[model samples]
Target: MYPHPHALEAVAVLRVAELLREAERERRLPRTSLRRRLAYWLRAWAEKLEAPNSQLGYA
Candidate 1:
């Protein structure tokens, strides 16, 4: 089965967040751009997933 665009985007955002958190833990400066981009992607993904009377499942 083909994956949805929003699902792919959500995965990308989660990966970025994991990288940023690791960088922060290592005392390295986390890139602001990455954080901002993650936020935007997550917001868009959430909007797509959250629909009236619809149940969404994530893998």
Candidate 2:
């Protein structure tokens, strides 16, 4: 069965978010920058899901 496009995008976004958060916690990313990057990625992912043909690229 084919998965819903939005569901797939959501899973992808969540997985990325988890990885980003982990990296941040591990000190791989700067604390102040982490928040900005996370918010950017999350918003881009949501936009991509809502607009399948949009040209936004994932991080």
Candidate 3:
């Protein structure tokens, strides 16, 4: 069944509000180390590539 148009609008507004709050939280967080940043990128890459856990290496 389809949702009411107003409900979809409300959901979009809520999501935008949550995203704004998340951005604010990120701005307040401490700077990450180079190694930590590298690990994060590696993890994201592995996920995107659908690589196996064994191939993730030192990350």
Candidate 4:
């Protein structure tokens, strides 16, 4: 049996959040620019959410 299309979504979201947080924690992403970086993440996430996925989770 295969996993569902939405199954990996949470993982993706978590990973993105964690990576961004880690970047910020390491001071790689400036505090002043955090909002822009987060906005980019949100757009990417929205794109993934709105994409039409096949059963295999491909576009």
On lDDT, the leading prediction is 2
Local accuracy by lDDT, each model = 0.62, 0.67, 0.49, 0.66
Order the candidate numbers by lDDT, best to worst: 2, 4, 1, 3
Poorly placed runs, candidate 3 (over 4 Å) = 28-59
Q: Please give the lDDT score at residue 30 for candidate 2.
A: 68
lDDT of each residue in 1-59, candidate 2, tens digit only: 99656566777886776677678679897668768777678866765755756454332
The model with the greatest TM-score is 2
- lDDT accuracy of residue 59 in candidate 3: 19
Which should have the higher TM-score, number 1 or number 4? 1
What overall lDDT, based on C-alpha atoms, would model 4 receive against the true structure? 0.66
Tens-digit lDDT string for candidate 4 (1-59)? 98776768745765776687678679897666766778478657745754787343534
User: Which pairs, if any, clash in model 3?
Assistant: none
Report the Cα lDDT for candidate 3. 0.49
Reference-based lDDT, residue 25, model 1: 78
Worst 10 residues of 2 by lDDT: 50-59
How does each model score on TM-score?
Answer: 0.52, 0.54, 0.43, 0.50
Higher TM-score: candidate 3 or 4?
4
Locate the minimum summed-lDDT window of 10 residues in model 4: 50-59
The segments of candidate 1 whose C-alpha lies over 4 angstroms from its true place after superposition are: 30-56
In model 3, the worst 10-residue window by lDDT is 50-59
